[model samples]
Target: MKLYPIESGNFKLDGGAMFGVVPKPLWQRTNPADANNMIDIAARCLLIEDGDRLILIDTGMGNKQSEKFFGYYYLWGDHSIDKSLAAHGFHRDDITDVFMTHLHFDHCGGSVQWNKNRTGYEPAFKNAHFWSNADHWKWATEPNRRERASFLKENILPMEESGQLKFTGLPENHILENSALGFDIFFADGHTDKQMIPMIHYKGKTICFMADLLPTVGHLPMPFVMGYDTRPLLTLDEKELFLNKAADQELFLFLEHDAHNEIITVKHTEKGVRLKDTFTTQEIFN
Candidate 1:
């Protein structure tokens, strides 16, 4: 199996919203913000080439939104899925599965795109089966007021409309066994209902995709949780348990939202789980 870091693009998000109650002085040290207090954010996606299946985890926010709509996020960078795929000698048609961690715009917005005539939306990956659990699908489709803005219909509805949307077993099941993809998904509810974090066993290493569970090295501390999380206390407990186990097992964490640090590992310190090391995908995987 081979894994590639597909950087779709970069954008800026309010540091305060990203860090929650963590003081600006503390988070700024790791993810320094701009003059307007917005920090750099990356729509980093993962591509898995396992045998006949090419699985894509999280399609970063696509370029279909209007300028006014994207103005809020302060989009930046030239890296795109097409360019990244071409670098790997692959194309969007090669994708057999689109495993979404959640349905947030920044995470799964690229799943659908405007058609040729701009008449309506269509599945971005024409040959892929979009993977999303029943619970998350419902939660995103019928979003609550707090999360409604993040779950855009243009980013989601087309998956099902295309007749390629598939559920990965029951959301309650801790591990959704996808033997074909060579990964068992671990579900977390704190970030959003039924957020599936893929636990991939590759090349004698277990690579856990840290999709919002641990955004960056700055979020290593137990108290540093995102304000966007619906249940912050649950996130604290989940992070504690997940990090401790990850440290004990010496697992590699593949960060999604961290613009600078690609991958990181945690260690058990007196202050609880802390960043041990950070490396790019090539540095470790290659």
Candidate 2:
């Protein structure tokens, strides 16, 4: 199996929102914000080549958003989703599966794109079977008020409209129980309803895609939850349990939103779980 780190681009998000109750004084050291209190974050995606399956996890924010919409996020960076995939000798159509961790614009916006003269939206990967669990699919499609702005119809509806959208069943039996994609869908509700965190069995280790659960290396601490989370108290409990298991099993967390760090390992310290070390996905196979 081969894994490629596909960097869609970088964008700015309010640091206060990213670091919940954690004061600016604490988060500023790790990710300094501008005068507007916006911090840069990487919308990194993952592409896995396992035999005949070419699976892509997340799509990052696409280019369809209006200038006014993008003015807030400030989508800066030269790397694009297509460019990053081409770096590994792949293309959009070459992807067989698009495993979306969630349907937030930054995570799955690139799943669709403009057809001709920006008339209609079309699945970005015409041949790929777009993957999302039934529960999460419903949650994202029928988003609540707090998350409605983040779940854009342009980023999602096209897949189902194109007849390429399929979902892994909810209440998945024993993880991979007839899942649409290959990996086990570990569900967590702290960030969003039934967010599917892929537990990929790759290269002799379990690599967990730390979606919003662990947005960045700085979010390793239990209290460093995102304000975007619907339930911050639940996030703390989930993080503690999740981090302890990660430390126990020595798993490499593949970070999606971390600007600088790609992957990291955690260790149980007297002061609670702390980052043990950092490494790239390429370093893991080596």
Candidate 3:
């Protein structure tokens, strides 16, 4: 199996929102903010090429939203899914599965796009089966007031409307091993309901797709949870458990939202689990 880090796009978000109650004085050291208090963010997706299946983990926020809508996020950078795919000698059509960690616009928005006529939305990857779990599908479709803004209908619904949506089985425990996508899925809830973190066994190491569970190295501290998370307390528990295990097992964390740090590993520090080392996808994959 081969894995490629797909650079979907980059944007800036309020550092305060990204780091929750954690004071700027602390988080700013690792994730320095600009004059506007915005921090650089990346929509880093993962592509898996295994035998006949080419599975994409997440497609960054697509370009279908209006300028006014995107103005809030302060989008940046020249990287795009198309350009990144081309660099790897592939295209969206070659993708057989699009496994989303969650339904947030920034994560799964690129799964659907405007049709040629611009009359309506259509599946971005014509040949790919969009993946989500039954629990998350329901939660996202019927979002609560707090998360309603992040779960946009335009970014979703089209996959099911196109008859290409598929659901992964929810595990009874924290993990579902040997999933249909050919990896173990670690179910996390603190960030959102049924947020599936893919634990992929590749190249003699476990490369975990750390979705919002651990956005950036700045979020390594125990209390550094996102304000967007509905259950911040639960997030603390989940992160402690996951990070401890990650440190013990020496898992290579494939960060999806960290614009600068691509892959990282943690080790047990006196202050608890802390960043041990960092690596680019090329360094680890090649």
Best by TM-score: 3
Q: After superposition, how far is residue 240 of candidate 2 from its true place, in Å?
A: 1.5
Consecutive 10-residue window with the lowest summed lDDT within model 2? 171-180
Error of 2 at 217 (Å): 0.8
Q: Which wins on lDDT, candidate 1 or candidate 3?
A: 3
By how many angstroms RMSD does model 2 differ from the true structure? 1.6
Q: Provide the global lDDT of candidate 1 against the true structure.
A: 0.90
Indicate the TM-score of model 2: 0.96
Query: What is the TM-score ranking, best to worst?
Result: 3, 1, 2
Give the lDDT ranking, best first.
3, 1, 2
lDDT of 2 by residue, 1-286 (tens): 8788999999999999999889999988888899889988999898889999999999999888889998989878798989999988998889999999899998999999999878899998989999887888888889999999999999999999999988887763324543566666667789998787888888789888888989998888788999999988978887887889899999889999988889999999999999999998789845
Model 1 scores a TM of 0.97
Please tell me which model should have the higher TM-score, number 2 or number 3. Answer: 3
Q: Which portions of model 2 show Cα errors greater than 4 Å? A: 172-178
Is 1 or 3 the stronger prediction by TM-score? 3
Where's the lowest-lDDT run of ten residues in candidate 3?
153-162
Of the two candidates 1 and 2, the one with more favorable lDDT, higher being better, is 1
lDDT per residue, candidate 1, 1-286, as tens digits?
Answer: 8899999999999999998999999999999999999999988999999889999999999989999989999988898999999999999999999999999999998889999999999999999999998889999999999999999999999999989999877634456676335688878889899898999988888889989999888899989999999999999988988999889999899999999999888899998988898889998677
